[model samples]
Target: MNNPAPGASAPPPAPAARRTIDIVNASLKRRYAREARFRFMGAAAVFLGLLFVGVLFGDIVAKGYTAFAQTYIQVPVYFDSATLDPDGSRDPQVLANADYLGLVKASLRTLFPQVTGRAQQRALYALISAGAPQQLQTMVRQYPSVLGTTRDVWLIAGADVDMLVKGQIDRELPEADRRIKDSTLTLVDQLKTEGRIEQRFNTGFFTNGTSREPELAGIAGALAGTFYTLALTLLLSFPIGVGAALYLQEFAPKNRWTDLIEVNINNLAAVPSIVFGLLGLAVFINVFGVPRSTPLVGALVLALMTLPTIIIASRAALQSVPPSIREAALGVGASPLQTQFHHVLPLALPGIMTGAIIGMARALGESAPLLMIGMIAFIVDIPQGITDSATVLPVQIYLWADSPERGFVERTSAAILVLLGFMVVMNLAAVLLRRRFERRW
Candidate 1:
């Protein structure tokens, strides 16, 4: 009825003209600018992070590459009756009683009979590992029948000789400044020409344990200890951590006490790892009387450290499961326990595994806690079980890093490489598992 609209109504204020710039600014311009800025910032941050990682990796590789190549000398030595025993009778006890240094000296003397100066011979013998004599004695004792025969043995040389063979030593350095003498280098060159000395991949490196001589050190013992400790940590921490998380998330009453417990768990996760070590020391070591420095103690400490992480992750995963799934199960007359276990738990598994693996990785690289628990000891033998005293990879690295030996620098870097490799593998496993088992519903 009010057809009085038209141009009536006071010449309706001339339709406000829309500004093209305003439309562009309000719709596309602002959004595009904000998105572009956000993207640029994210990309810049990622690039900077990657740059730092690349530099760090490069440094580690540069410093550690030499450790993979080791120098060895193959010496032919004659075990004379005089050295093995004055009487030609091969007594096992006599062989055991033989001096290792005398054997090494005899071997060197036989190799270079023409060079008879005692000091020169001592210098040559110095190239061999101090431990070499003990090893030879063991060999002779093991095979007393080979007492009077010539034996060919591969002996690890001193760190100086190792540095020389590895090309780390500067030939330009003065004899006084250099660890290895010019005479030793000359012998090494001669040995190389004779095919008695060469550089090769150090298989012993992975099998040997910490030694005073870097050239003789291996990570095998530490690696085994780490494996056992981590295995124990996983076995003990995972089920308990996940169980606690599930109960707290799905069954526990929502009350102040529960809230306080949750708060404490979160706080524990943020506690300094060394504090956990101290706790373990007091409880596991002192009160429980679990052997100090044993894998059991170390594993217990790591389990404590990893428990909070697992619990947090598991709770988050369980929380992420849609409530509708549980309701649906219950709607069909399923009990609460059945609904949670059969329907929700499966859905949360992938995230739980990812969290557990990440926690394990963190535990693997932890050194401070292990240090306090006495895992810093020079453990050469692989542990027989969790109760045996042990040292881990990180602690081994720490021990090597603090050594006065020059070759320890490379050993430390090599250990870092190994630790990084473990972390990478764990992360990859977590990613693969999550992708394979993650459920959308």
Candidate 2:
């Protein structure tokens, strides 16, 4: 290069410095723009996810809130001595043999004094649950002395009345086409005015067992059964799952046997839930002679289903623990078990619990396996023990949903809400546990 004249003064160093600054500034701007796009995409994904969840919650609440309200009819029935005790004395056998439907009919007549025709009485009679007669019979058997007295009784009405009171009935429909006649509506209004028919918080929803009639249906039995089954599952699966994970992660020799085990675990995770159910039926029910449809059987099946998930998640969590922590614990003369329990386990606990609970939530919603094990059958009484017959929420919902009656639709939706509530509680518990036990270091 030729030397420039002295006066040229080295073509000002400012231009080259400006070019370098421009290049760096452009590169930073481009990087910042890309970062902003990624952040916006992430925020948009979060918003969409929240929106979907909100819609689902709103729909469930709207459709299922009515299940919490129950309607009851209050009526006074006179127990005539002729039917209850012909001898006019308290005879337990005679009282037991008393006509309960007669009492119900008399009560209905008293409730609707405005109508006297036999056909209308018969029509009004259809508005009472079929089980009401048995209920009255039971009451009389329990209280034999009440035979010759008039007493006020609050009884569950039929599903039609329930639907009407809950606004599920279309009032504009013609009287001939409506399941509930106009006469019943007139009586309902009168009863409403007299405070004899009212809606109250339905303790029955949580206290009573399943029924064919929507008015008599309750999830208490199923709820209890689910609780027992899940409790047992957690008890059995957690220790075993975690212990296996620890051994595999910390001490097991890496060999073909280990590899085969790992592969089997991964394969088991992908197995259909119903397959596990069938296995449980074959092995636990048939081979071992465990009672079918019991909470114990259900819990065992669920534990098997959840094991793979727990193992995989736990191993991942254990592996995520920094090796340096283990080395330090060993440096301080800590046994491997002690180091794992004291240091590594605490760090991995949040992830482990998250996985376990998520797996449990999956188990709670599973109905296919439950169906195979006879959890689909009707359970009129609460289960007394793990060996007792029982059902779960999903099975209850399935049984109800399969009913041909229109009332079961709402019942199914209601059961779904209950199941969803359980799932939400489980997930919330997992989130809380994760936050409460999480270790950043």
lDDT of 1 by residue, 13-113 (tens): 44443243334445665688899999999999999999999999999999998898888788887777776788867777777787878878778777877
The alpha-carbon RMSD values of the candidates against the true structure, listed in the order shown, are 5.8, 5.4
| Candidate of highest TM-score | 1
Cα error, residue 18 of model 1, in Å, equals 3.6
Candidate 2's residue-wise lDDT over 300-411, tens digit each? 9999999999999999999999999999999999999999999999999998998899889999999999888888879999997788899999898888888876667777
Best by lDDT: 1
Question: Local distance difference test, per candidate?
Answer: 0.86, 0.85
Clashing pairs in 2: none
True-structure lDDT of candidate 2: 0.85
